[model samples]
Target: MAPKSDSAEAIVLNFVNEQNRPLNSQNVADSLQKFNLKKAGIQKALDNLADSGKISFKEYGKQKIYLARQDQFDIPNSEELNQMKEENAQVQQQLDEQKRAISEVEGEIKNLQSNLTLEQIRHKEAKLQKEVKEMEDKLVKLRKGVTLVRPEERKAIAEMYSEKLSQWRKRKRMFKDVWDAITENLPKDLKEFKEELGLEYDEDVGVSLQSFSGLLQHGKK
Candidate 1:
């Protein structure tokens, strides 16, 4: 009861444009079966549509997929196009904001995972506070000249100081003897030679052996 159609190419082109999606030769063939069109005829029609640039296609090995070309659609007016552009810009902005929010949430999650728990943090803070309080109290006592050293400790410190002073005196004498022996026959000026050799005695840098003796006497008071 239906009229016979002659143009397979026209039917295939119309079908592809109407679908507006990618369709392989077999898909077109199957869909056109109701029109009594063979696969080979559908394939040939699709190829013709592609060749004439009425539709776009991609080939995967022996198979071909056809899609309707966007350029084949009617152009929108300037006002409509501007409205579409504005809508696209708004969508893009929303997408960017969503991405930023997602990144921030991910960062926060990682930070929380890496950080110490509230109970552990409080415990560490309390320990540090106790240490700081102890140090501060000791510092205040020291500033007030409080005698923290025991009598036995003071005696031991004095003995150590005396032994160190004896060692210093012996080493200084030995150094003087060595210096006299080495420079006895040298013709260079003694001060210039000492300077050239980068040598410095105790008094050269504002330190005197006499100062240590004075300090030892002052500590007794």
Candidate 2:
């Protein structure tokens, strides 16, 4: 059944139809800014619009912006429309291929990063494991009365092992890089770490690893 009440959505759509700017949530919000309505909630309501012919989509920056598409937008000739569609499809295809290639390269870089990180962790863990083994060996000899274990000596061993345990924990925590130089694989701990460090994470703030890597590789000239 059609919605029993579509007043709010109807209002938003009608407003868009009335003012035919390259509209976005901000535009819609700006239209309603004088009212007591929540501008943020207005954006949300518009976002929930159904795909059944009332709403239209356009990509602005990295987000989808909506507008109304109804009877009035003049129809182009079938051949020209088809040609436009074909060109759009070609561009979309090229974009998809580029994205796929970028994704593959990013995956390789992340894997390399993960592997390198794990290798470093493994090295530290190995060194700590060796220390643990060496401590156990020394304790065994001391137990046999081969040499007396001083109180400070015992404290030193305990402290060393505790430090090693803490180091291993830190390494294990950083096992994966979710944010790579490309950001396709940013560190999994990134958000938490950022939160802990009181940092803000901006989605579009920084250069992606792929672009940055390209700059480093090719920009020298």
lDDT per prediction? 0.88, 0.68
- Where in model 2 is the C-alpha error above 4 Å? 1-6, 70-221
How far residue 55's Cα lies from its native spot in candidate 2, in Å, is 1.6
Worst ten-residue run, lDDT, model 2?
A: 207-216
Give me the overall lDDT of model 2: 0.68
lDDT of 1 at 121: 99
The C-alpha RMSD in Å for every predicted model, in order, reads 11.2, 29.8
Tell me the tens digit of each residue's lDDT in model 1 across 61-80. 88688999989788899999
Candidate 1 TM-score over all chains jointly: 0.43
For candidate 2, the TM-score is 0.29
- How do the residues 117-200 of candidate 2 rate in per-residue lDDT, one tens digit apiece? 766889999999999999999899988888566778977866765565566556534533433433455555666756776754
> lDDT, candidate 1, residue 16?
90
| Model 2 alpha-carbon miss at residue 78, Å | 17
Q: Which stretches of candidate 1 lie above 4 Å from their native place?
A: 1-80, 95-117, 125-148, 180-209
